[model samples]
Target: MSVSHLIKHSAITTGILSLASFGLAASPSQAVSVDFSSWDKLGDVYTQPGEASLSNDNANFQDDSPQASGYYNLSGNNPEEASPNPNLQDFLGLDAESLDDDGQAYEGSAIKSVITAQAGDKLSFEWRFSTNETSNKDFGFFLVNNNVIKLADFTNALQSGTSGSFQTNTGFNTFSYTFNSAGTYNLGFGVVDVGDYVTSSALDVKNGNLEEVPEPTTIVGSLILVSAGLLERSRKKARK
Candidate 1:
């Protein structure tokens, strides 16, 4: 319970957390680039972080449903293309009938996938929005685990209003959630219509085959040094 003891324990606990993260990352049990149309089994598709194009289109997806099921409709997120939606210059359109004439298939649903993770798990993803949109606008993220304690780690609470694309962004605005208990949790994202007013988008779960990449040899050495320092501090305190 002493201050020095707490410091020593803190270092060890951090090492443990890092180890857990790496373990998850290394495990092949985590999914990667799941097909959006049938994403329930695996995680969902993330489109934007890809190189030239992003598509959860029925083009390669299972069921060929034209649109993925969970994308919520805000301004122009609807896939029907019955009315023309303004396209952003940098944004790619899938299932939107290739409004740019580049010949990319469009499916219109931005809800790429739904994923669930346990404590010490991190969820990282990317998304983009118009300069026309708010900076911190909620793109739709939720927690279903009854025992989750993201409250301690959240930079911001998961907001349910607002609409944009996270599943489609090439770079991710990652959300890290570490759970506190074991149970069947159902973390989900946008599929809500919300009466044609405001809407939200789902995150594309990626880098999901969680693995702890080995730190650089230098980092490993630094860790050893820090451990030694903690031990020295503990010994010094014991002498007093």
Candidate 2:
């Protein structure tokens, strides 16, 4: 093919890629949130990028056992009790928990998905971590990026009771993070048990959302405009 033909083809390909990156081409003002109302359905959340499985494990849902009110109970005994084999903090390459706590013992699950958003976009969710096994134990949410643990900005403090208290009436505690660039992000929500014992904590989360910013579209448009200009120049040169 001639150089002009190649330029035209390239421009067309780029424009299609730009549209694909936008996912649903939602208005910049709208934000997408994931929530669960019943054990059977999780609104707008998935385990994988393209698949529709909502729960990573079948035992994660506790609508009847704990009267969960549509929340996940991140317990250690989902499939079976964790052996407390390895200290989770060490396994995750994080500093050890405060010495006053039980050793690193993690028995939990995390839900992951490839979330699309632009630079400056904000993604957030609400969670409650409760454990009666305080005295140096906790659970938290981790945001994984590119297979690495990027942030652990939200974790619960040690509680004084065995029964976890759900803040459903007044709303759960909110955790938010902002994206610095536009692309696919490996977003994750997890719950963990930080001590060695059968006593487990619970991580109840709801209302996950991605608040998109409009800047990425502007960038894509500029690229298309430049590509169109180049294509025009190529056509003029070929005709001469």
C-alpha lDDT score of every prediction, in listed order: 0.33, 0.46
Best by lDDT, which number?
A: 2
Model 2 weakest lDDT span, ten residues long: 49-58
Residue pairs with clashing backbones, model 2 = 101-136, 132-161, 132-162
Cα RMSD for candidates in order:
15.5, 11.8
What is the model-wide C-alpha lDDT for candidate 2?
A: 0.46
Runs off by more than 4 Å, candidate 1: 1-38, 41-118, 129-139, 143-171, 191-205, 209-240
Candidate 2, residues 121-177: lDDT per residue as tens digits? 887766655443424343445554633332221134433333444322222467788
TM-score of each: 0.29, 0.47
Over 71-169, each residue of candidate 1 has an lDDT whose tens digit, in order, gives 332222233221244221112222323222212212223232345445444443333221111232322223342221111111132333335433222
